[model samples]
Target: MRFLYSVAWWLALPLVLGRLWWRGRKEPGYRQHMAERFGFYGVRATNMPLIWVHAVSVGETRAAEPLIDALLRAYPAHGILLTHMTATGRETGRALFGKYGARVVQSFLPYDTGWMVGRFLRHFAPRLCVLMETEVWPNVMAQCARHGVPVVLANARLSQRSLAKARRLSALMMEAARRLTCVAAQTEADAVRIRQLGAPDVQVTGSIKFDVTPPSQMIAQGAMLRARIGPRKVLLCASTREGEETLILDALGGIDLGNSMVVIVPRHPQRFDEVASMIESRGYTLQRRSALGDKVVAPAVQILLGDSMGEMFAYYEACDVAFIGGSLLPLGGQNLIEACAVGKPVLIGPHTFNFSTVSDDAIEAGAARRVNDAQAMIDGACKLLRDDSERMRMGQQALAFARQHRGATARTMALLGPLIR
Candidate 1:
C-alpha cells in the first residue's frame, strides 16, 4: 500500500503543480509556500518533544484552537508544531497563537510526497500527530506511521461523496487509515463513512468547532458596535467569496429597506482590497473598518467593508441579520454558527454541503433561513429586517440552538487525551 501510495504521488505531482500554479495566479503566497514545502527550506525547529497538528486552512485552524490550547496546558513540556496547507491558515494560526509563538510554531505543511513528508517528520520528530478535520494526506500519514509516530484524525468527518471516492480506492485509503491510531469523527454518519474508507478504531467525538467560545473582547466590541449602528437595518455578509459578493451587493441594491447598511467581510483577508473595490464599483459608499479609527461603526457609510482579521465575532454582534457566504455559489458555505452564537438571525443560500449538518439543524430549529438565489436573499433579508419581532424571535432561537450544540470540543478532547499525552 505504501509503494502504491508513492506511485500515486508520483503520478499526481504534475497535476498538483498545475493546480498550485493556477491558485498562485490569484494567491502568490500560496505558490511561494508550496515551493518552500517541496524544497524543505526553514523546516528545522528547537530541540523538544513536538506534537504536530495539521489543519488545512483558516476554518480548520479555528476549529483546532481549543484542542491546541488544551494540549498545551496538558503537556506544557512538549513543543507544539502547527502546519497549514494554505497561506491564510498560516496567518490565522499565527494571529490566534501569537503569545504562544515561542512554544507553538506555525508553518506550511510539506507537499504530500515521500521525500517532503520524510523531511518534515525528521525535522519535527513529533511524538504525536493530529490531523484536524478530513485533511488526509496519504504520504504524510505513511511517513508518520513509518517513523512510529501515533497519528490521530481529530474532529474528523467524511462526507458521503468523499466516502464514495475513498471506497473506489479502498485499498489505498484503508492502508492509510490503518496507520492512524484513532479517528475521532464529527458524527455517527461520518464515523461509519470513515470506517468504510479503511480507518480503524473510529469514534464519534462530535465537532470541536461547536465548543468555540467567542473571546470576551469580541463580545465587548460587539456591544459597542451595536450601540453605534443603532436601529438601522444591518445585513452582515460573513465570509463571502469571489462571485458571491457581487450577488450580495446586487441584492442589497434592489432591497427597498430604508436606512439599511450592508457589511461585507471576505473570508480571506488577502481579498479585502478586491472586495472593497467591488463595493466601490457597485456605487455603494464604502467605509473600511481600519479607516473608522477606533469607531465600531461608521455612520456615514452604506457598506462597511470589514477588512480586518479576528473580528468576525465583533461584527456579528452588531449585525441584525447575517448572510453566511460561500454557499451562494456552491462553495459549500461558510459556518453559520458564528452568527447564531451572537443571537443574530441567519440567512444562507442553497449550497451548504460543507456544513450540511449544521445548516440543517439551524433550519430545523427556525434559527436560519435558506434562499434560492440573489433575489430571494434580498427578499429574505428585507423581510427579516422589517419584521423586528420575527427577527428577534429567530435570533433567540439561534442563540439557544448554538448553546445546545456546545460540548463537542470537550468530547473530542476527552478522546484525544490518551494519544496526545
Candidate 2:
C-alpha cells in the first residue's frame, strides 16, 4: 500500500501543481515557494539543535502557537524548523516567529514519498518532531521510525466521520499510528478513536486552543471599531466557508436588521473578494474592513466584510453576537473558542461534527447555541440581540467556560517531557 501510494502521488504531482495554480489566481502566495515542496531548500542556523513542527494550514498553525512557544522556552538553545503545506500557514508562521529570525525557520514540508521524506529529514536533522492536529502521512511516519526519530502528534483529534474514513485505509493508518511516540489527543473520544486505530500510546491532554490568548492590540482595535460603527448591533459571521456566506446573507435578507450590521469574515483569505462579490451580487450594501481604517462606517452599510487577516479577535470583540461559519455547510465549524475566549455569545450551525464535542459542551454549558441553517442562525442571533440580559449572561458563561478549559498546554508538555531532551 505504501509503494502504491507513492506511485499515486507521483502520478498526481502535476494535478497538485495545477491545483496550486488554480488557487493562485486569487492568492498569489500559492505560486511563491515551488522548490520547497520538492524537498530542495537551504537551511540556515544549522549550528544549533533543531526541533521540527509540521502544521499543515491556518487552523493547525494557530493551534500550534502555544506548543511552539513552549518548545522555544523549553529548549532555548535549539532552533525550530516549522513546516507548512499552505501559503497562508507559511505566512502566519513567519509573522508569528519572525522575531526569532534564524532561531525559527519556516519551510514547506515535502510530499509523502520515501525519497522526499528522507530528504526532508536529512536536511533538518530535527531532534524532536511534532505534528499538529490530525495530519498523518504513512510514509512520513515510517521514515521517522526508520531514522529513530521520536514523533509526537500534539493536540490530536479525530471525529467519528474521520475515524470511519481512517478505517477504510486501516492497514496504512494503523501502521502510521503505531509509529508515533505518543498521541497527545484533545479529548477522550479522540483518544479512543486513535487507540482503536492502533496507536501504541495515546494521552488525552485536552485542547491547546483553549489556552490561546487574544492579543491586547486586537481588543483595543475591536473597541475602536465598535465606536466607529456607532450604536448599531454587530453580528459577526466569523471564519465562514464558501457556501456558508450565501446562506448567512440569505438569512440576513429574511430578517429585519433595522440597526444591526452583519460582519462576514470568510475562513480563507483568498475568498475575501469572492465573498465581497457575493454580498454585492445579493443586493446588500457592504463595507470592507480595510476601507474603514480611518473612516466612520456609513449608515447605509448593511454588511461589513472582514477581509483583513489576523484580526479575528478584533472582530469578535467588535460584535455583540458571533455566528461561527463552516458548520452550516458541512465543512466543520470554525473555532468557536476564539469567540468564547473574548466573552461573546456564540452560535454554530448543525454540521459541527468536526468540533462536535466542544460545540456540544458549549451548548450544554449555556455558552453557545446551535442552529440548523442561516435562517436559524439569524433568528437565534436576533433573539439574543433583542435580549441584552440573555446575551450578557451567555457571554459571561462563555468566558468562564473558556477559562475552565485552560492547562492543556502544560498537560501536553508533560506528556512529551521524555521526548524533549
Candidate 3:
C-alpha cells in the first residue's frame, strides 16, 4: 500500500506542480521557493542542534506560536527549524519569528515522499520533529523513523470524521502513528481517537491555543479602530469560509441593524476581493480594513471587510459580539478561543466537527452560544448587541473560561523535555 501510495504521488506530481503554478496567479507566494517544495533549500545547515516543527498553515502556525516560544526558551542551545507547506504559513512564520534571526529558520516542508522527506531530514538533521495538529504525513513519519529522529505530534487532535478517514488508510496511518514518539492531544476525546488509530504514547495536554496571549499592541489597535467606528455596535464574523459570507450577508439583510456594523474577515486571504465583491453585490456599503488607515469609518458603511491578515486579535478586541464562521457551512469552524480570550461574546453555527470538543465546552461554559443557521447567528448577535448585561455576562464567562485553560504549553513542554534530552 505504501509503495502504491508513493507511485500515486509520483503520478500526480505534474498535476500538483501545475496546480501550484495556477494558484500562484492569485497567491504569488506559491511561485516563490519552488525548489524548497522538492527538498532543495538555500539555508545552510548549522552546527547547532535544531528542533524541527511542521505547522502546515495559518491556524496551525498560530497554534504553534506559544509552543515555539517555549521550545526556544527551554532549548536555548538548539535552533528552531519551522517548516510550513503554505506560502502564507511561511510568511506568518517570518512575521512572528523574524526577530529571532538565525536562531529560528523557516522553510517549506518538502512534498511527502520518502525521497523528498529524506533529503529534508538529512539537510536539517534535526534533533526532533514536532508536527502541529493533524499533520501526520506517512512519508514524513517514515523518513523520521528511518533516520532515528524522535517525532512528537504536538497539540494533536483527532475528530471522529478525521479518524474515520484515517481508518480508510489504516495500513499507512497505523505505521505513521506508531512511529510517533509521543502524541500530545488537546482533549481526552482527541487522545482516545488518536490511540484508536494506534499511536502508542498519547497524552492529553490541553490546547496550546489557550496559552496564546493577545498582543498588547493589537489590543490598542483594536481600541483605536473601535473609537474610529464610533459608538455603533460591532458584529464580527471572523474567519468566515468561502460560502458562509453570502448566507451571513443575506441574513443580515433581514435584520434591522439600525446603526450596527458587521465586520467580515474571510479565512483565506486570496478571497479578500471575492468577498468584497459579494458585499457590494448585496448593496451593502463596505469598507475594507486595509483602506481604513487612520480615517474614521463613515456612518454610511454598514459592513467592514477585514481583508487584512495577522490582525485577528485586533478584530476580536474591536467587536461586541463575534460569530465564528466555517461552522455555518459544513467546514468545521474557525477557532473561537481567540475571541473568547479577548472577553467577547461568541456566536457559532451548527457544524463544528473540527472543533467539536472546544465548541461544546464553550457553549456549556457560557462563553459561546450555538445557533442553528445563518439567520439564527445574526439574530443571536443582534440580541447580544441589544442586551448589554447578558453580553457582558457572556464576555466575562469567556475570559474566565480562557483563564481556566491556561498552562497547556507548560504541560506540553514537560512532556517534550524527556524526549529532547
Candidate 4:
C-alpha cells in the first residue's frame, strides 16, 4: 500500500505543481517556496536536540500554540523546529515564536514523497515530532518510522466527511496511524473513530485551542479600533468564505444598518481585494482596515472591511456579535471558540459538520445560535444588536462555556510528557 501510495503521489506531481502555480496567481507565497516542497532548504542547519512540529496551515498552527508553549517549557534545553505546509502557517509561527530567535526555527514541511520526507527527517533530526490535526501522510510516517523517530498526532479530530475520505484510503492511513507513538484526540468521538481506523494509542485529550488566550496587545488594539467604530453596534462576519461574503453583502444591502457597523473579514487574505470590490460594487460606503491606518471609520461608512491578518481576536473584541462564516455554506465552518473566549455571542449557519460537536455544545450551552440562511443570519444579528440584555446573557454564557472547557492543554501534556522524557 505504501509503495502504491508513493507511486501515485509521484505520478500526480505535475497536477500538484500546477495547482500550486494556479494558487500562486493569488498568493505569491506559494510560488516563492516551490523548492521547499522538494526539501531544498538552504537555511542554517542546526542540531540542538530539536523538537519539531508540523502544522499544515493557519488554523492548525494557531491550535498548536498551547502545545508549542508546553514543549518549550517541558524541555528548556531543546530547540523547536516549527514546520508548515502553507506560507500563512509559517508566518503565524514566526509571529508566535519570533521572540525566541535561535531557540525556535521555522521551516516549510517537504511534500509527502519518500525522498522529500526523508530529507526533512534527516536534516531536522527531531528528537520528538508532533503533527497537528488531520495530517496522516503515509510516506512521512514511513520515513519517520524508519528513522526511529516517534510521532504524535496532537489535538486531532475526524469529521464524518473526513472519515468517509479516510475510509476509502484506509490501508494507507491505517499504516500511518499505526506509526504514531500516540494520538491525542479532541473528543471521545474522535478517539473512537481513530481507534477504529487503526491507531493503537488513542486518548481523548480535548482541543488545545481551548487553552489559547487572546494576546494582550491585540486586545488593546481592539479597544482602539472600537473607539474608532464610535459607539455603533458592531457585527463581525468573521472568517467568511467565497460565496458567503456575497450572501453577507446582500444581507447588509437589504437590512437597515442605521448606526450598526458590519465588519466583513474574509477567511483568506488573497480574497481581501475581491471582497473589498464586492463591498464597493454593492454601493455601500466602505472603510478598509488596511487603509484606515491612523484614521477612524467615518460615520458615512456602513461596512468596515477587516483586510488584515492575524487579528481575528481584535475583530472579535471590537464586535458586539460575531457571525462565523463557512457554516453558511457547506465548508464546515471556521472556529468559533475564539469569539466566545472573548465574551462575544456567536451565530453559526446550519452547515457546521466540521465543528459539529463544538457548535452543538455551544448552542446547547447558550453561547451560540444556529441560523438557517442569510435572512436568518441578518435577522439574528439585528435582533442581538437591539437586545442588549440578550446579547449580555449570551456573552456571559460564551465566557463560561469557554472557561469550562479549558483543561485540554494540561491533559495533553500529561499524556505526552512521558514520551518526551
Top-TM-score structure, candidate number: 3
Worst 10 residues of 4 by lDDT: 39-48
TM-score of 3: 0.99
TM-score of each: 0.90, 0.98, 0.99, 0.97
Which residue pairs does candidate 1 place in steric collision? none
For model 1, how big is the CA root-mean-square deviation?
2.7
Per model, state how many residue pairs clash. 0, 0, 0, 0
Error of 3 at 15 (Å): 0.4
Q: Write the per-residue lDDT of candidate 2 for residues 115-179, one digit (tens) a residue.
A: 98998888888888999999999989999988878999999999999999999988888888889
Query: What's the lDDT for all of these models?
Result: 0.83, 0.89, 0.93, 0.89
Pick by lDDT: 2 or 3, better one: 3
Candidate 2: residue pairs that collide? none
lDDT of 1: 0.83
Off by over 4 Å in 1: 1-36, 39-45, 227-230, 295-300
Deviation of model 1 at 412, angstroms: 1.9
TM-score of 2: 0.98
lDDT of 2: 0.89
**Which candidate would rank higher by lDDT, 3 or 4?**
3
Best by lDDT: 3
